[model samples]
Target: MPQSAVDSPDLRLTLRVRAMRREARDVLSLELDDPAGGLLPPWEPGAHIDLRFANGVERQYSLCSDPADRTAWRVAILAESPSRGGSRYVHQTLRVGDLVTVSAPINHFALTPAAEYVFVAGGIGITPILPMLAEATRRGIPWRLAYLGSLAERMAFLDLPQLAGGDTLLVRGDLDTRLDLTAWIGSPTEQTGVYACGPERMLDALEQLSLDWPRGALHVERFQAKTFGESQGADTFEVVASRSDLVVSVDRGCSILEMLENAGIGVPSSCLEGVCGTCETAVIDGAPEHRDSILTPDERESNETMMICVSRSLGDRLVLDI
Candidate 1:
């Protein structure tokens, strides 16, 4: 179901910033390439890479450039108002030609085959949709995009020519502008899929509208970990790292990832809050309480893999592929 293939989740590379450009008022776009002039790993639409800054801060940014262009990878970073160290570092300290540590691409928001596609992007959420649109055009897939931005000057990729056409709708204004979600998306039909990415409130509104649609109709990606209240029914559980031949006891306050890391078993990970799918571990056996933000409803129901960072066991024991 729309699940993107992760080539190598633990693959890391050192790349140099080939160039930097100001796409918008607060947006900085960086083009990364190998210093030795070599091709990088191939990725698809809705894929993102984890960039580890010089300051040792890691953050995931969507691949906004054409996936076919393997010469270089592009990502846009918004100068976050609160300055979470990542945005500030990229804007102020990171420079062109600087070496950076980057993780291989990961995709939890892959675009699946559909008769018709609908995309809704809000502000920086437009990053992943850029490549999706390119792929859709290459495949001759019928699609429409609704780009909503708070301010005209702050929006990125405004100069993109692909966005100018009847198939796309651009709405820019302040907080006062109200969008009719139902009319914009219309009634769902057979084989019609909707992909949306934005702030919590924006996604929340869409979620409300999706209640009437068929299951697995609407797909979304989040910029942050959703608020899941305190752990409930969380008791001590045991995890068997099958590959490592070790069994670790997980405490109520501790997580499976933490337990493995503490036991000298490293699971290549980033965004330990479960927003990133770095710590996704294969579940050989046992039921897991999935709490990650990356998986689809169908994927969760399948219980094939579990994000050890935030997810836990639903039973007394869990067997992991590690």
Candidate 2:
């Protein structure tokens, strides 16, 4: 079957499991193959695919392989009780040759050139960081990887240390001590870029520490997003999708994007909580609330940018060029 629209428009891709491994107690490295073609769509670092299940549940997982590797895309799934069912399905029911529909890789977090890069990863978060480490290594970019795992035995990648070469720093929390990210991310110089992916607490700490650094110096990808502040704080507004000639009420409980979608207006979106830039649209009029994490304050102030995922309008209404 084709991995895209002709076969399944909803997800746009498919993964026929080629290999699997017991990375940890509850984590597994699943190597997925292209459905029919030689390779899948090209992607960059920090890209992710939305995995769809037979039961109709869809969840996103970050691509764990180097984007340059077109043969297959790798992802690590960790089973958790509160899982919305995506990880549980992959960890338990998914088999070596089973086919799973996946979406084209979409990237919101991308690597930028830095004199020095420090990657802080915790447990399953290490998957995405592995690709970046490989890219850095290939380019001879000076970098350091601080990986924290529950135990040496439970660390997913057995080849992690070897892959990172001499720049790798593995911290086994089950053995020595809990990691102090502040000591690792220290005073950020102009040329340094700090990239981290892990638990919410780790991300929060990184965010707080990054406040003192340059605006774009710290790059982060959180699997779970901090929710957008409710629209009650927003002024009740209207949005006119000029092209559609649709006027939608941007109410206190409804976002402009939600209103549009509810009205059967389709706007490309992923990670609707505001981290991914998929729902970004051009604002023709009215000041935007700028609730998304992807855009800078300056970009938001320009009114040329808007993240429909969470941001709403400031005044009576907004006129979007969409």
Candidate 3:
């Protein structure tokens, strides 16, 4: 389980962009370092930092640099075509020597201990896997990577010697070669773990393919909002804030976060689309119509938490630990 958002370190560092280089077509990698030459907070393989822009737009990007590098942090951003200003701002407005506010590293997609590992990545998804590969190599754990991209020229970090070895398979969409998901993800064993990060469709396909695999053996990180299945219909629901002794009515079209904000209640949120776990709230009572992609199957089954930004009460009322 992940640590509560409330307990997260209040680390807001203003780091200067030491360098910015194009890793691939439309993808830029930024190396941020402390202006005072201070050591930055430590981060693990799958951890991501929230990049807060001057325009109040915050976006999460995975830490792609080596974890042992305490003096600097690296992140790669792909200029999204129809971006909501986050990626475009980073690509156009951000530059070397510019100071940017960044939150401490958070890991909702943490890498767990395993004997053997198989990593699958698509396009910019390879950012998070880069560090994981480094960790695996350092630990001497057997691992393989299947990196898929639309084109060879647009693939980032392919020139790196670590990814150029035989253990890595570079699959280009423009080419006739296809990645055999079944062959790579064969019958799962308790000792083996599979980690994948990619587009929604790819993650969905992998999720379907790994249905019979051991629980917790397969882990994934999605770059986009997940598609929700048929729900019990968007009926109005009541939410009670246990500590504040407040009750708010949420309309069918309104989200709990929206309603709370309207009532002057503060809730921390990022990527209100439910991909980021920032707005996860404790559920004290009532069944929540889980819509977020951050929670695991077991976590959802436990009904201990819900992403209030996109989730709603399954029943008429929900009791929250807020």
Q: Which structure among the candidates has the greatest lDDT?
A: 1
> In angstroms, how far off is 136's CA in candidate 1?
0.9
Total clashing pairs for each candidate: 0, 0, 0
**Residue pairs in candidate 1 whose N, alpha carbon or C atoms collide under 3 angstroms:** none
lDDT of each: 0.86, 0.76, 0.85
Give lDDT tens digits, candidate 2, residues 2-98: 1221134653876799999887778888888876856888887778787777766666778888678799988888887787878888776878888
Off by over 4 Å in 3: 1-9, 164-166
Give per-model CA RMSD: 3.7, 3.4, 3.2
Tens digits of lDDT, candidate 3, 1-322: 2222322447578889999989999999999999999999899999988887777678889999999999999999999999889999999898899988888888888889999888999999999999998888888888889999988878898887657433898898888488788886688798888999988888889888878888887888888889877667358889998888899999877889888877766777777888878888899999999988888888889999999888887899999998
TM-score of every candidate:
0.93, 0.89, 0.93
| Candidate 3 to truth, TM | 0.93
Worst 10 residues of 2 by lDDT: 1-10
Which pairs, if any, clash in model 3? none
On the 0 to 100 scale, the lDDT of residue 237 in model 2 is 79
What global local distance difference test value does model 1 have?
0.86
lDDT of 1 by residue, 32-143 (tens): 9999999999999999998888897788999999999999999999999998899999999999999988888889889988888899999999999998888787788888
